[model samples]
Target: MLRAGEPGATGYREALEALCRAYWLPLYAYLRRRGCNCHQAEDYTQGFFARLFERQALVRADPTRGKFRSFLLAALKNFVADERDYAQASKRGGGARALPLDFGEAEARYALAPSDTLSPEEFFDRSWALAALQQAMAKLKAEYAEAGKEHLFERFKGSLQVDANVASYRDMAADVGMSAGAARVAVHRLRRRFRDLVRQEIAQTVSEPAEVDEEVNYLFAVLTASV
Candidate 1:
């Protein structure tokens, strides 16, 4: 996603930082799954970002090629392959201009992932999908908060992409101070908004607009795959 443009272009730095924030956990988890201990994995992940910035590796990306995640994972695998020592990386990683990660929270979240024999790549794909969904949801929630409809958002969030089946249209309509028809319309609008937000989120992780739906479907498949 951050690899969409030239290295020194406007907003490139911010884009890079955002991408790092969205993905560092998944990368760290992949490293851990590959047999790296916490400290080693942390070092490797940080150092990889550092290298990306320092070397401007993103400028080498060819948008016509493939998904951003695949490009990134390939780069990371190469980085790890070339690194001679984790101890040295840990020492140097302190000076790397990488995004800060809350290791405690990251490890706690990783602990909740199903531990049934998944490969590192499989785990990374699932984690990345979850992260993308979370970012979209957070953005949607913030939009409602800014509109002074935070409570309404909370009540209707379950209807963003599903019927929920917990309440009838009339029942939900009463809770939201709307008639059943209006409530149904509200639900339809929210689902469309959510779908647009998801598309936007997926678009950022791809090289082209046409790839967004393809990427979105792949991510959902990854999330649903057997652990």
Candidate 2:
């Protein structure tokens, strides 16, 4: 985040893009929960980011305030309130270049959200947690694909957060043509790698290295509540 906060610094744009990509869905989810239709939500999410860059919001962020997630939600609240007249959503983003957000699939994902029991903020946090898990899982898959082990990763991925009994490792071994013991060992390695990736995802939003574990716990709690 500090890297993103400094414009023209080495890696600044990369850092900013990473932040944008990770949180865009959560922000869109927030808008949807706040009663915006899909089109309004997409336009608002795009406009918020455009305004963020225009005003140098990142450069002015103070890590002392709180986690990046909270800061972003607060910023979004302000943006939404200020743009209450966003019937003009068409005009707002028509002139600014947009971010590479996956608005196409965003509504499909939002359709699977829990029934309207959660507040907008609660929904945003839940989406954020899920999104983090997704990003980590994708990165893990990509690593295995690059190593020519996509089949192995896919076979054991369900074991990443489970115990030694990932349904039936013996069956997995038979399918993958490996010994049962080898499958168990492979699953153990996959679980270890997945935990590392999850931790890395948590570490991104926090101001201090020590905050990752607490953030991870909070993320799980949000997911648990939704379930």
Candidate 3:
């Protein structure tokens, strides 16, 4: 995000574009909670990115102020509030080149708890935290795959957050063909590595490293609420 802070920087677009690709879902979820239908949410999500590029959002973005996710949410709010942009976004064809976001399963994936009704802002935070967790887990799985431990990751990932609910280490070790103590240590190390990966994921969006811990705490809080 430092690229966004730089004046006339070459990589700012790439940096923000990466963010757009990775986090479009949260924005979509926000729009949905704001009363948009599936198609409308998809349009607004893609339209925001299209307008983002058109307006040079990176130049106007100041990461020094706060987290990149906040900037995106605020910018998206502004975009949705504009009557002209809303009208334009609703159009099926207006020479608006769409961003390559896959919305095929967007509606299907959006399963809000029947008992839990959330405001748009709450929805955004919940979605944002979930997105970060998903990104972190994906990165961790990729790392494990590179190390020839993909199967282990799949088996142990369920126990990443809670150990008490899982089977005893002896049972897991017998299933995985490892000593019980080694299995316990392996899961311990996996949990530690996952924490580091999650922190790294949070660090990517903030200007200062100090903001990472706050963001991480907030992320978990938001996710826990959804549970």
| lDDT value, candidate 3, whole model | 0.76
> After aligning candidate 1 to the native by TM-score, how far in Å is the CA of 16 from where it should be?
1.4
Q: What is the Cα-based TM-score of model 3?
A: 0.88
In order, the Cα lDDT scores of the candidates are 0.78, 0.81, 0.76
Candidate 3 lDDT over residue span 42-155, tens digit each: 777877788777664545555557898898898888777763554666673233545776677666557643336778888888888878778888889999999999888887
Model 2 / residue 102 / CA error / Å: 2.7
TM-score per prediction, in order, is 0.89, 0.89, 0.88
Ranking by lDDT: 2, 1, 3
Better-scoring candidate (lDDT), 1 or 2: 2
Backbone clashes in model 1: 0
Q: How many residue pairs clash per model?
A: 0, 0, 0
Where is model 1 more than 4 Å wrong at Cα?
56-64, 94-97, 164-167
lDDT of 2 by residue, 1-227 (tens): 45664566788667767887887999999999989888788888888888776654544455334587887888878777766666666676533555877787998899987786899989999999998899989999999999999999987887766665654888899989999999988888888888899888777777777888889999999999877
Candidate 3 regions exceeding 4 Å error are 4-7, 56-61, 91-95, 112-115, 164-167
Clashing pairs in 2: none
Worst 10 residues of 1 by lDDT: 55-64
lDDT of 2 at 221: 96
